[model samples]
Target: MLVFSDLEDQSGIWEETKDLFASDFLYHHKLTEYNDEIYLDALDDIQEHVWNCGGGKITQYGLPPSRDGEKTSNVIRREKSYNKESLQKNVNEKMSLLNDKQRHCYDVVMSRIKNGCIFNSNGIFLNAPGGTGKSFVLNMLLDSVRSQGKIALAVASSGIAATALHGGRTAHNMFKIPLMEYNEIRTCGIKKNSELARLLQMTSLIVWDEVVMANKNTLTALDITLRDILGNNKFMGGIVFVCAGDF
Candidate 1:
């Protein structure tokens, strides 16, 4: 049985358990012994509960997957507090650490993100060579937007570039951009109804670093997938896809 007292702990498992069984005390009582029929019954109940919570007929996966053969790792993470006041204060303090140029860039990005500039279907490319505090500004942008109940997808063209920011991953890894050399592989590895599609749809901003080095093929692949899922052919389907690089 999952630990009831630790439901609020940030781990994915306990959070999912807590979400599935709102009454921690009840689940605690239900788990008297391991492999007991009662325990199994409780498991079944929680599975059904999760399924029901997800709109009952596989709108998404918290329970059984919609595709039988599809494999997934449904990691349930407890989200950081989205208290705007608290986050704004923290962001302000972080801004103080930024140099003038960095602060200016951060402010512009923040304004655009908050005021729906991304809806214009034109992506922005910020160019600043190494040591211009590009990473600092990116971090600030991610934190500020994520704090205000928005999703910021951070990725970099290469593995090394990916490590510079929080929650960063390689563009290929995060967007499922395959390394195929031919244009025949048009769409990305994301399915319209899958969780990856859901994530892309939920994302309001995408920050890509080291764009100078990323293959054009890779970007094209991502562009195609975004268009398919977003139901439009415009840039990232009206989502902000900011590419940053410097000579």
Candidate 2:
């Protein structure tokens, strides 16, 4: 049996060889043991085979043992075959279309998705001067997310603006925002409406446009309602909130 005077000295080689075996020939045989001498002897055998065949020097590392008890020569063939197939598969699925900026945004969004969208900030404020393409950017992002099979909802202070963004009425109409009755204070219970409740629960992205025009009291009320329904599970609503407005 091949042995090593100090196993730790060759630990790196052993790990690399193990990964090679798993990726290249895992189904062929089970690796019962690992020894430095055995690995080195396998390499020498490969070199000898190449020499006998009158080929150039065949330098390689981490050869897998054969399932049929053949020499290490078979291991190299298996690795070549496996690697070629995996490479082709990867190339075939590569992305076809995405501008640089869009790709960057997509990567950021994907990272957030992997981490589960419970962003630290209570909200994200995207600000720009009027007609600075803020709305254009928002619409592009919305389209990208939707293309990925996500649902995005757009709401604005004005019905016309909201309709322009989402192809429908304002968030008030979509979310059923009622006119708050003065003095009653509690009479305007927009949060209690089942429709708004469902939207809040299921929306993956909430784009509140023209936030500057939103009344202070109504904004406060909306925040309170969100806190009550969403609780402390910041991302529980299935949507990340993004507010865009001009100062």
Candidate 3:
């Protein structure tokens, strides 16, 4: 994966076979497990290409056939996948389960999502000990946002923690952050025109679990990438970034 960070250092054979880079990466890492949404966009592109080559017209299932169709489809698919009624019910039921401390954290995060912070913090750091129901509160927050027809991303520093949340993925895979730190320009691999970028742009909230397990450069890279992709100067491109972990 580090080879993706430096084009100049790559060998001549790698440069000639650069078109297979994505396929190689996917084949080796099995990214499809957690990265289905982005891969769906790629499938759309492939189908479109085959249709054009075979002189067949592109058909739309739920998405348009325009240039940005895949991006729109991915966003709409994610938005519609949530059962609003069930999510709202879950949120309501879960709210009562939150203890005083957890309830306060929930309220603070939801409020930040509703009302922008004056200092542009747009970040909520929850420091708690183990067995404090941090995951419970995080799920409630995710449900609360999704219930309102908004997009909330659940990601974690590690895959084990990711499975604890609803529709969670590893933060590195979700953001396309390089596995190994390269140079100082620390930036994620999300192209501005890709569906993944569109997803991030539409994201209202992001819950990152076990955040302390991640390297600082990972977060820095995400910050820089989000600012560029979302075209916002605020922290995390003004997205509600929630970091929860046992410290």
Candidate 4:
């Protein structure tokens, strides 16, 4: 009766030891009419089991395997798991060295996320030249939000450029934008009630680099697709977009 979603939660220990964690969640909780106390207690037990499976508390689980057997890269995008403690440790080390300007930018964006005003703010753009540390700033922001258990997407116009970002994928690959030459209007490759659409709805932040390389059609396509998926007409379907590039 127990079921755990590999699609939404981060993959790693959670997936490896899902069998061990499921007995309680899929069976006991249902039998008890979905008791919170029981669920929390089970989580405690499951956490201990997960720790023991990894050779006790001292061992590290490390990163996930990079086997893209299906080439369904969405699995990685939808389930980006990071070592929260280790990620925080790394981000802190990086944050300490930021220049005053970088620090200011980080603080402002972090403030928006923390204050929960991101949706209200509409969007953000880290307008800077190549040497101005735009990528560093963006990485810090992504790490900050991710550490707080929020989803942040990283995309770029080019595959090579996307590699430098966290969970970064080409915007076309991730969004599934159509490549039609004769089309007057455009729509994304996302289908209704599909996994990509679900992920888009759940995403809290999107950081797209190399925006200048994309055309107005691409942006319009994204907006139209989002409107379709999110059922709204507002810009970017009311999601906060952080589009950047050398403009």
Candidate 5:
């Protein structure tokens, strides 16, 4: 004979009581108890008064609203707010600065994007010594994708490197990959219904700068999480993935 003023307040026990029987009860009576026997007895009457408002709103436990406790909507908005015209202008200016070898790398990556690299194995690794403009080429690739009204994720293994790219974020922060040692089956901490998940689904390209510094397990965790969120078993959920570093 549990009593409550509002069902919403008892959301914690909602699922536990879903199967409870009222012993003998039916609607609009100020108190309705549900039991298999009573429910069957008053089936027709109960059907008349029953209407589905919708599923109860429950936030997933251990899930934060967004990365670093930021608002979910703010994260989503920031990802999509880049000006296509401005990005295109910046890309055009930067194009002329690329060396011949760098320009060739840029063309190869852009071709992958135009041809829908998601359906195929489109992964690139730029291995060169320092002072070779790896960051310059990575930035060019990011701008090209974003200028076309598509999402391009730019992340780096370290904070200093991440700050150099447009809209860049630390790889661990962006994907919620754990820092400590983890099992092979472990995935990132991203929830499927989270705002970060939505952004990942919409992304066309992912440029990881200084990727050589990241742990192998961190990369594997990202792979597992992306596949789960995007519902695609393909590598990195079919996003064009680029890894650039001196290693």
Candidate 6:
């Protein structure tokens, strides 16, 4: 039969048991003798419990049955604490600089980060006639994320507009996107190079400005090329894609 004492003492016991399970076969044999069925049952139960508690699982062998529950609980607590710390760090870093709207947008973007959405792919349609401070908002967002030690790449369809963003450059120059116009199959020959591929893989954020100017066909090609180059075009280094354009 299995037994648990007071919740607090049980929790403390688990912490110590977790270490024993890390190594030492004596505990493993003891577990087998105590209740093999419960032992196997606990593995799945603990995994689910930990996950529900916002903790991930780690596997280990040669542990006693008495230690399993405590070990799992401790691991779950530790993971939860660690994630809390990371989130606090990110928030504290951004708190001072972001204003209201920017803070809202930043929160939305950061959700992807917390949810493990790695392919920083997002389309921001800034539809407020020309000169509505859209550019200002974009710049602020970029600076905020960069200040948190993330790389932000800004690319625009036009050279002049790209320069206006201060730190931004032409999409062609930044991503090396082919200049082939839509419907012209062989206009821009495909190049088999790894430099741009590597950059895409490592880059955290890709801000494509003036996306409205990009032809549908060109956009399709760019998407396909990026998807091909990056094994998973979902999220790049926890980077977010913020596209600011006038439509």
TM-score of each: 0.65, 0.49, 0.70, 0.65, 0.68, 0.51
- Of the pair 3 and 6, which is ahead by lDDT? 3
- Candidate 5 lDDT score at position 229: 94
RMSD of each: 10.7, 23.3, 10.4, 13.0, 17.0, 18.2
Pick the TM-score winner: 3
In the range 134-166, model 5's lDDT, one tens digit per residue, is 988997888788779888889999999997787
What TM-score does structure 3 among the candidates reach?
0.70
| Winner of 3 and 5 under lDDT | 3
Kindly report the root-mean-square deviation of model 2 from the true structure over all alpha carbons.
23.3
lDDT for each residue of candidate 1 in 167-205, tens digit (9 for 90 to 100): 678988888876677565676788788767877777778
Q: Judged by lDDT, which candidate is best?
A: 3
lDDT of 3 by residue, 3-50 (tens): 123334324533354345335324322245425443444444444553
The lDDT of model 1 is 0.65
Ranking by lDDT: 3, 5, 4, 1, 6, 2
Instruction: Please write out the lDDT profile of model 2 over residues 1-247, one tens digit for every residue.
Output: 0231224433356446644534312322123454443354454444445445654343222233323333334322322222234333432344334446545544554445445535454355677688666665565555544445455566788966775563324656555446765233331354544445644554566677888886665555556666566554453243466677898
Clash pairs, model 3 backbone: none
lDDT of each: 0.65, 0.50, 0.72, 0.67, 0.70, 0.52
Superposition error at 189 for model 2 (Å): 3.2
Runs of candidate 5 with Cα error greater than 4 angstroms are 1-72, 117-119, 182-185
Stronger candidate by TM-score (4 vs 5)? 5
Q: Residue 56 lDDT in model 4?
A: 25
Per-residue alpha-carbon lDDT of candidate 6 for residues 90-140, written as tens digits (9 for 90 to 100): 546746665676567666655544454543345445544576565766665
Candidate 4, run of 10 with poorest lDDT: 56-65
Off by over 4 Å in 4: 1-78, 116-120, 182-185
